[model samples]
Target: MALTLRHGVFMAPFHALEEDPTMCIHRDLELCEWLDRLGFDEAWIGEHHSAGFETIASPELFIAHAAAITQRLRFGTGVVSLPYHNPLMVANRLIQLDHQTRGRVMFGAGPGLLASDAMMLGIDPSTQRDRMLQALDVILRLFRGEVVTETTEWYTLVNARAHLLPYTRPHPEVSVASAVSPSGGRAAGRYDLSMLCVAAADGAAFDALAANWEIACRIAAEHGRSMDPARLRIVAPMHIAETREQARENVRFGFRKYIDYFNNNSPGRFPVPAGTDPVDWFVEKKLGVVGTPDDAIAMIERLQGQQGEFGVFLQQTHDWADWEGTKRSYELYARYVMPHFRGTNAARVASYQWVGENNVEFSGKRQAAVEAMFRKHEAEMARSGGGS
Candidate 1:
């Protein structure tokens, strides 16, 4: 069987917090609606409680609202930051969402990133990963209808069971977030879940790409679970336009804002020199693909060639282009990019050519056969003395 790539977007929904709160959220919903109309596969909303620019605090709520506005587009929490909430509630809430969305939910769990958010919750950043693993373990058990009775430092559940099961055939697909880390891979392997590599475009993360999956597979072997490369997804930022120049010019507006947001909030992680061409900085950093639709296709194809089999290519969303430009990028992807990998458009073309080539010969033979039949009938009539 041939591998086909699925397209999705990973939206942090970044907007300056002071910006019109109403309009920001409305735009996020509109993004999902646009994706559904464009026949995209999925949209995963990010969760962040503290960061002023990274607005969406509850991705589940946003997913629920987006689910109503769109059809056939699956939604995920993007990473619910498992350490902050109780395991039972997380399990129950996700299961309920699966039912509500008719199984169109994919659970992507992670040890929350923002240290300030963890500090506010009184969670030690050092121990958060351990807590996340503990919570995820209990949640997985609860999902399987097994009663969980455990007392961890953060929370306790007494024989908790989820009577309300998921609508998906086993359960909605579960994924663990990895940022060039072995811990995320181990958790994914242990739970037999999908792996969502969040910073695939970052140079360091890209270097660790092959090693991370190897770690997951090794751990999975120890746990008697065979890892599937198709369950791995790599995410990157991209935008498409009519030409490279247009794409380069279009991303400058929000590209600068995006760089500024990071430098101001999480200093040193993404440092951009002042007054540099945003497009040059973008390309030099290997941050993402910004070119024509064909360029986007080549970017993904090259990644696949290097990384081997992976399931989905999730484009990171930023307000890089104006509204129409952003939507056109997605349209270009669905129109020119996706069909190439899926082999759908190529198949249609081949089928039409086959019909076109055979039709004339088929018609000519049928006409000759019909004429012969009439001639034979007329001859028989003349021989019987009934000829005109």
Candidate 2:
């Protein structure tokens, strides 16, 4: 199979113009328009409920509107929080969006972070894994046009069927965002789903991600199944510019905003080990690629070599809230980085062909917690008839 370099948009809620929320929406729309013109393969929106910073709480609604405006660019939820939704309803919405976009929809599902959001909805967050597995089974079955009736500890669906069928046969491509977790890799292998390894500029982190993929591939072989390296994806925060200095300056201020946001939300203050400052680790590790066009392309090539058959190069310019810089970065990456690998085929390895199963018992307790909370909210909504 030929290797395809998939370009995608990472749409974060930009509150640059804090006084006017609509302006942020418009800016995001404009960015989408630019991506379409630039020949990007997909645009991924994230799902975050009640997060004051990013307003795209409902990605399905946003992507539906995006479908109307763009002709070729695909729309996706970098992930829709599965534990928070009824799988049947989400499956219907996904299929509808796929049809609206004319078969250009990719599904990225996850059990969300943020305990406070779950708590507000009265969810225990403890049973999140069970919820994710059950929900995933339902959604996948629905996409496959199966009449599913499943009773799990957390959820029960009795002979539920979807009226809205996805345009893609057997459903559109599905991916899960793995944030440095072995469970993510195992899940991808277990379900035959794509594993999207989230990358920062850090080489060490990238290496660790590659190791996880190796484990996933090995596990798949044990189950008498095989995974193509091309099916693996890497999502990185990247910005490419004319010059390295310009790239640094362009991304610095915007990147700082994201750093502040994460730092503020991080729980517990652990003392740094004598030689390891997080900032230094980030730059040394290259967690977020901020460099000239040539440098960015080189970094991607390096990542591809390590990760194998990397499919998507999701450029996250919006995270910085610098529209002009974001546009420029996209253009630069398109002009320089994409051409080398866009249509190349993912390389195959003999070692990854088949292996014995380790019978890894992965647990998703956090995922369960989010699901329980969301189900409670769904129940309340059903009683009141007030939710979508």
Candidate 3:
């Protein structure tokens, strides 16, 4: 059977610095409602502290509010920066969320993303990944009903156990973030967890897609576990419009701010040479799509070609466009791009073709039936001496 690719948003909640922070955050919540109404499968909210642009600090709190407003859209931590929290607290909160959402919660864990955030917390950037792994181990144990008693340089869990078991059987779908590193793959392989390839849009991470999956599969086999491609999610940035030119224009709203954030704060991650057009560079590098649904389809097809089969395509949500334009982009994606991959219209298309192919025969039968009815009516009229 072909994989049914799920679609969602990975909202770092990137907003322009000039926008009011409160309104920006509310708009993020509204965006969740908009996506849910558009039939998006999920929305993974990010956890970032120091980044002024990617401002949502608590994904859990955001998920709670967003989940209440939306009916069906599942929420994820987009990764709960595991190194930043104690395992016990993380597990408890996740369990509560799982129950609260009625199992519509997914737990995506990762090492903290912003180096500045880590610095403020007194966590060394080098140790974040290791700490994430350590935390994952304890969180898993707690979920499985184990009383964890362990000590690490960063955290100590002394007989730590969650009071409530996860509402999701076998626990809410656990996923780890994978960018360019093999660490996410290793952790997923060992724990038999899902993966969130957060930076699949980046050229370097794109190149590592197959290699990282290979590492996961190899390590899974060694651990006597099997990695499911259906559990793997690839995230990339995209903005769609009615036309390529229109999309390019739409992103002009705040694309510069996004570029500035990366170039100034996190340089080299998303490099745009001084003179080159940002959108052109972005598309040329195969970093993402900023065009029509056709372009989005091509980007996804490219990813499918690279990684074979994966479960989800998470659009990295950004303020590249205005509110209405952003909403329209998602609506267009739902109307066109999603169905292409999902085969949502395959049966409908087949039915349409079958009807069209038999149109002559069906039309002939309808004419014959109408003629027969007229003839019967004339015979009855003649018998009654009322025929003309």
Candidate 4:
């Protein structure tokens, strides 16, 4: 059977550093609630400590808060940088969180993203990969109720065990972050886990996605584990409107923020020669989509064709549009783009056609009843009563 695509938001949530961090967090929670009400399937919160903008330091804490407000939507750590924390603590918190949220939590693991963040934590950036692998090894074992006794340069545990099990059967959905590298794929496959391709919009990763999954399967084969493409989640930033012109115009409001974010913080990632229009350049690179719902649908379809049928399409919700416009864009996606892949509108369309086809029968019976009433009045008039 074909996989029905689910909608979600991959929120690294780049707010300008100048904005109030407190307000930024509030808005993120609001975004979660908004998505929940709009019927989005999941919302993955980003983890960062040193970055001035991507300030949600603990995705687990944020998930707890967001879960309290939202009813049905699931939450992921968006990747808790495995290199930064003790794996046992990470596993324990997530397991307890799974229970707290009534099993709406996911464990997203990754090597720390920022070199500066690693350095600040007294870690060499080069050691992050090894650190992540070791930490994840322990984390997965703990989730499976194993008593781990592992020691590493950064952290150590002696017979550490998780007394509280995850609410999700087996365990919470564990997703590994992937972009242009085979590390994430290999790790996910070796451990039998899900993959979150966070760089689906990036020019580089967009092309490498198939090869990445292929690497995962190869690694899984070596580990005697099976890989499921349906467990993959692709992330792309998009804004939808009724018209392309409106989308282009609306995206301009936060266009500079987008470029400046990459140019300054994510230095050299976006090579816009300091003079040209950043918004035009962004669209020219095809890094993000800003158009009508059809454009959104087409982008998703193309992703599915290129990367295989993924379970989720996560909208990268940078502060590209203002609050109201952001909400409106989500509404457009829910009303139009979502139904296309999910095939939700098929049932509604079928019912409409059924009603149209069956209407003639109803009208014929009603017409006959009216004619019989008229005939009875005509007889009464002939017998001495007059029809009004």
Leading candidate by TM-score = 3
| TM-score of candidate 1 relative to the true fold | 0.89
Superior by TM-score: candidate 2 or candidate 3:
3
**TM-scores of the candidates in the order shown:** 0.89, 0.79, 0.97, 0.93
Better of 1 and 3 by TM-score: 3
Residue lDDT tens for model 4, 254-370: 768777767675778888886887767776787877888998888888888889888999999887778888899999999888888889889999998997899899789889999
Each prediction's number of clashing residue pairs: 0, 24, 0, 0
Candidate with best lDDT: 3
Kindly list the per-residue Cα lDDT of model 2 for residues 1-388, writing each as its tens digit.
7576777766755453243777777777887888898878888888776646666788888888877888889877877878888899889989988887778788988776656667776777876655776788789989988898877655678899998778898798888767665766777787888876654334445668777887788888888888876667677776777886777777665665565455555632222345664434444556666677777777777777776667777765445526777788888877766665654322333223322222232235556778999999989999888765
> On residues 343-365, what C-alpha lDDT tens digit does candidate 1 reach at each position?
87887899889978998998899
For candidate 2, the C-alpha RMSD (Å) to the true structure equals 24.0
Each candidate's lDDT (Cα)? 0.87, 0.72, 0.93, 0.87
Candidate 3 regions with alpha-carbon error over 4 angstroms: none
Clashes of 2: 24
Instruction: Record all residue pairs in model 1 with backbone atoms less than 3 Å apart, i.e. clashing.
Output: none
Off by over 4 Å in 2: 14-19, 200-207, 267-282, 319-321, 343-388
Model 3: per-residue Cα lDDT over 1-388, one tens digit each = 8899999999997888889999999999999999999999999999999868998998999999999999999999998999899899999999999999999999999998899999999989999999999999999989999998888897888888999999999799999999998999999999999999998978889999989999999999999889999999999999999999999999999888888898777778777888999889988988899999999999998999999999999999999999999999999999998899889899999999999999999999999999999999989999999954
